[model samples]
Target chain A: MLAGGHGNSNPNTNYLKSRGLWVAYSIGMLVLHLILLSIPPLSIPMAWTLTNQVHNAITFIVLHILKGVPWIPTDQGATSLLTHWEQIDEGRQFTKTRKFLTASPVLLFFLTCFYTVYEPHHFVANFLSVCLVTLPKLPLFHKVRLFGINKY
Target chain B: MDILEPMYTLVFTELVPSFHVHLQVLLGLLVLWVLFKKSEKPGRPGKAGKSELDIINDWKPEPLVTPVPAKHRGLNAPVTKNQIAQHITVNGVKCLNFATNNYLALVNQQEIDDVAVAAIRKYGVGSCGPRGFFGTVDVHLELEEKLAQFMRTEAAVVYSYGFSTIASAIPAYAKRGDICFVDEAVNFSIQQGLVASRSHIKYFKHNDMMHLEQLLSEQAVLDRKNPKKAAKTRKFLIVEGLYNKTGEMCPLPEIVDLKNRHKVRLFIDESISFGTLGDTGRGITEYYNIPIEEIDLVMSSMEGSLGSIGGFCVGTTFVVEHQVLSGLGYCFSASLPPLLTVGATAALNLMDGNPDLVKELNEKCDQLHRLLHKSETLARYFRISGCRLSPVKHLFPLELKSGTENELQKIVDLCLQDGVALAVPAFQLNDVKFQTPSIRLTVNSKLEAQDMSKCLSTLEKTVIATFKPTSTS
Candidate 1:
């Protein structure tokens, strides 16, 4: 009777609940995704199908929860799952960094507005600020910094 | 000035609430700025604390751990020539000719070298500046034309790398208010392109058409709802001809059909498949028999297959010319080195000359796959796909079989010690994880059967030793 009580009253119940919430949220995302498909004037979907999206959503949800558990590290089931997660994250970061660099022009437009408001009369300050924010995004700027600005 | 009177009134009289509020906000921001200054790092105020050379001399190269004979011995020990490979000697080792990206063995070939040399002599070195800034040379045009012909497209523009190819091209062609539907398994480059653009991007799961369809449907609804607000001209479906990590063929024919029926534009990245697929190594467009016209944009890196140093995108003349002039990569960086361009052009030419290269590559893939499957120790956990070496290579997942990254690393170490180079990938989708852990073995046409057999034997020994329970180090 005592053993059963301890098992039932374990604090991991909250952890499991949180895990369950994540899972449910993932499922809901899949449903939302499905609903998104039905509402559209969508003409052509790419290589990915609705079923694949759901499968990936399920995969991501399960992997995220498992990654948080300490015991997960040693377990075979959780280990490979975690590896896949690392790969995906690495890919995402790589892609994101490049996009951020290219999108600097768009970001500069916002910075320009901010500059106009912050330093209204100082022409040199606004020009320098715009240059500072936009320079690093250009491939030429990156190369110059990497190789030396005076190298050419 | 008239502006001074208004400013004076705001500071002195406080006549307008709007002016008074703006002044107060400005004062608050100045106070916050002063506060932030106090939190910065405190460095020596006057002179350097010590000589830079003195600090440098004191620094020591500390080893992570004392060398372990079973695992790390090879890394530290002086390697002899025979240990690495035949006909290739690097760093005093005749390293096994396994680590090269010379898929068709065309990079160093005499024919390729001659063409490259000829182009260099004719064009001179360097495009001098960005494509937008007098960098476009006759050689560059010739290369682009050749690429268009090879890919069977109307026009093509080259970039520095596969990452730049996608990042630069997609954003140039598509814009904000436009919708781009991407494959979950798409490369980092494609993702970069999407993020750079102002378009609303929807991600579908790996190889999931239904999800993509749904996304399109949703976008259509959104467009209809706000038809007058944001002017969106068209939707694009983007994917790779071959996924980089997973050696699986994309459902190209199906995707093409979808594009035709749905009136959506299709973009394909054929970096992996360019020289390793189809009869003439023309890539997925050829393999699937999809018309070149159906593919609005084609992007690929010449690094992996052609063994060169850049990437390219083929499309309509308008799009290609525009991308050349306005794409961020084209407008920013120096054009490809004349030598690299010539080498790539020569590689493409070689493929045209030797139709059997693809056939030979397919056989190497098959043999390697068969040998791994037949291995007693490796067969249990490792799965090898067929000999075709599809768009991404064969999807032999290491993490899936080893159960953990640590175990996967150990297995990888064993193979490395035995002199086999493998590609270990950390790949993700929609912020989730996945690893197509199998080594990316890029087989060259010139490699002998013995070379492959030796590599396989080393892999077998490594696997057996790693899995053997009783074998003490």
Candidate 2:
């Protein structure tokens, strides 16, 4: 509703497209990093360095485009919503175990990368094994299960 | 095998092929461009020639309007100093002082002066910062502890100014969404406190218990409609021990009963009543025999009875602690001067040593009240109001006239001319409620039987001359 577009256009569509772009970019970068790790000639440390630089560059470009395009959701609306959510959440208490559970997926992904660098392995097999274990725990998939498509 | 060997080898040798790294960087840049173009797919087809900067530069905001100052009636003469007991010099004329609040006549005590002089020689003058900073000194803490012990509260906190004590203490507990039920005829300081709290304020008629109950009942109905909000909203009842404007004692016993029945916190401001009421001058709570713990907060100004500057709030340890961090005046304003604090300490000690001074002051209040009541001329024109034991008394005109205030001001000036001083109530132009225009007389222990008689006779002659009946058929 705040994007300054035609009245007939669905505001939800803009929200969903903006959210979907983030999800797609995160997934694409993860797969590209794994592919780079599979090249036998590239050392593990060099591959990791390249992955981090690429990730920063892609994030900068995506955020710049999202801010300039009028049809995409503005940063102001997201910030307001996040602030409202935080105010509501401040009154409720959450357990330590629940917090740890929410953060486990990111932790697991970093552990798998460390293990692969520490011990030489078949790169493709190790990458596939890590993906199978980490994909379900990704926050994007959990959000989909909890809120469904319309909420995005 | 060594850590230094690995660091040297890494710095000397190229870790990855330069061509491959450049290719990856270019690929990331190309991917970003593609994503940006895709995002633009949903935007409008055409582009404007001017950039967004041009549009922003052309924008203008609305202008602000300046406020006009309110017109005021200027005073005929300004008071100069406390020349002697029960007298002050106004416009270079010595008049019997009935305007000051020095109820115990301790303003110019020799002991207090000696203590103040000694403190100045030791601690110098100002504290130069807020309480939490480097402002607090040994005397400030001693005074706070003494006040707490004097009031029989668990702890107490002192502020730099009298007006800001209540103003800061109210908002320290009550916040934006809270509800405060206030007396309609409270002083300007209490009104300022209510404004700063930003709470939902409902005013009851002055000292009207039935009207206050009606408002409480109405609030109950509204709370029933929104139980969630009701659960979160805190309710408070604020009143003064002896109202500064009317000089009447608040019905504290009835107020405490209502507070219990309605489950509301009670806050009492005893700025005028402290050191001027009760047998030993413990204030309204002692007068009514109410326990100190029953009231949530008790605030008073040292300017009135202590014969010094600053104010204080005495309460339980928990309630008093919150003010250190939350009270705006205490946290931000410069601390009270060490000399004044020591002077107040000496005054409190004198009060503790000589409880007879309070008794003498109480007798003076009664004597003055009796004298004013028995005056035939005053009785014919005005209604004498306020408790018999209150040092402050108010005289309201029985009939209203178009030039009633002008007539009252003329009477006050005549009293000054006759070597007696009387005060006319001054109200802010934009105040929400207007009090009746009246003359206020402050009684002090220093006035003798003859002085009281002389003051009454002066007022009588002035009133008779000003309001003589017109010749009738």
Candidate 3:
């Protein structure tokens, strides 16, 4: 077990609770972005720009909130877990692969944003697509184990 | 793009026109407020009503083990105002100082002051940035080169502060998986460095080479059991050239022999011994007639012996160069001020010019040791502890009465009242291992024969008065 007691036996319930909270946070952020998009003072391009800004702001705030939640591990906790696992060769390799997999969605979202900046016509589609891509990377959702298999 | 254009126009021209931006702002604020309010409510279902502050208020801090006296609660009287020489004014009284580390009494030397003043005029007080970022002035390089030359090493690296030099150097090379064999009686700075390294540390009895060898043999047995792990693990032996806590010199010859026999790297901290030990004062290596190249690294603080404000590590070029990129404090902290570096440079020049000063300091240490050793009054109350050559001496009580430290403090207070200054060695409360309460006296070269006699007379009187013998029935 890690210092934070992250390797508890009741993984299924903990994973579900964390996944549920992450889903709720992601939906709340999406609704906030949509509301900013529907504002009358913003033109189509302006609305799209406002939506991306709201997306970043809401994600940051929600991640901070998730850090305080017990079931979801904070970045510091994850780093400690990485260090603990690094003592063993197999576990170190596992952690490295897990980190790369975990980072892919955020990397993809930034790449999509970069391309959408030059082609503004697909801005709304790109924004929604990025939001969808980020869902699996959320604090709680990232911890979810499917069919008795741990994803992280 | 075409479908989105019509949709964008419809939303902007028709749908969004009915709703104002202000209302949208208010709606967004309301949603955020509700979300935050929900989060502010406790996550635990049963404890939703209690506020966060209420939980924090219920928490209590751990009580101190030994509560400090109310009179000593705040800052004590400032110890440094004028130069830390043989005589210093503390709380406006000129007292014979036996406390400061101005061993050679070069803190207020005319030549050093002149050079410092000149350097300040040329380069300002502060370095403004770390060494990597425009902080490396010419004086810093000069000091490093001079230090390397003086210590007879291929290269050396200077640290901005004395304490961080060893702390950063240890971790820079010895990472988590490595093993370190340390002496228990090393000063706090070395302890901090060992902690920072995160390496497997096995502490032997202080200055006990037999115990150290036993530990090494046991480690060898463990290594033989797992040959692959042993091959990968880097072993290091760390000891102080002159131990500050116990005020004794390390047996360096045996340590060097052990280092070769065990194939362990040797790192010696010569903070107290540098410019204080040896005939000409190159350090323990010179004092013991051991070649400097045998030791993997030699670290010393310029503050103690050189009467300056920084530290340096002397080693081969390859080892010293690694610290530039790896040593955290050297890379992160602002470089040593140009004035202080130049001051150290001047002091080095003085030592180089007059090697007799080092010789004189050694003679003074010996004289003071003999004077204290022969005092009947001191012999009745306390046992003097330290090497004859070490300037720093410890007076450990022969018998520990329940409140011996308080009694020692009373003697120190009385000595101060009588115009003689002494120091009570203080350690962190967490460090329960080597906390033998003793009065520490520092002997300097500037002290005349009469001055030593006067200080010894005052100490004898104070100790006798504090711990007067009671006749047995």
User: Which candidate gets the maximum DockQ versus the true structure?
Assistant: 3
Sort by lDDT, top down from the best: 3, 2, 1
Residue A70 of model 1 has an lDDT of 35
DockQ of each: 0.01, 0.04, 0.04
DockQ (model 2, Cα): 0.04
- Give one digit per residue, the lDDT tens place, for model 3 in A76-140: 12222122112222222223223332343344344334334424444445445445434434334
Q: CA lDDT, every prediction?
A: 0.60, 0.74, 0.74
**Candidate 3 stretches greater than 4 Å from native:** A1-152, B1-68, B78-81, B469-473
In the predicted model 2, the residue pairs found to clash are none
Give each model's clash number.
Answer: 31, 0, 0
Give per-residue CA lDDT, model 1, range A27-83, as digits (tens). Answer: 665575467557556321311133333433344344322322332111112222222
lDDT of 2 at B260: 93
Encode model 3's per-residue lDDT on B289-398: one tens digit a residue. Answer: 99999999998899887899989999999989888877778988999999999999999888888899999998889999999999988887788988999989999988
Residue B410 C-alpha lDDT in model 1:
66
Error of 1 at A80 (Å): 45
How does each model score on TM-score? 0.58, 0.68, 0.68
What does candidate 1's lDDT look like per residue over B303-380, in tens digits?
877877889988889768777545778767988878778788777777777889888876776666666567766666
Evaluation by lDDT, superior candidate among 1 and 2: 2
Clashing pairs in 3: none
> Residue B66 deviation, candidate 3, in Å?
12
Which residue runs does candidate 2 get wrong by more than 4 Å?
Answer: A1-152, B1-76, B82-85, B469-473
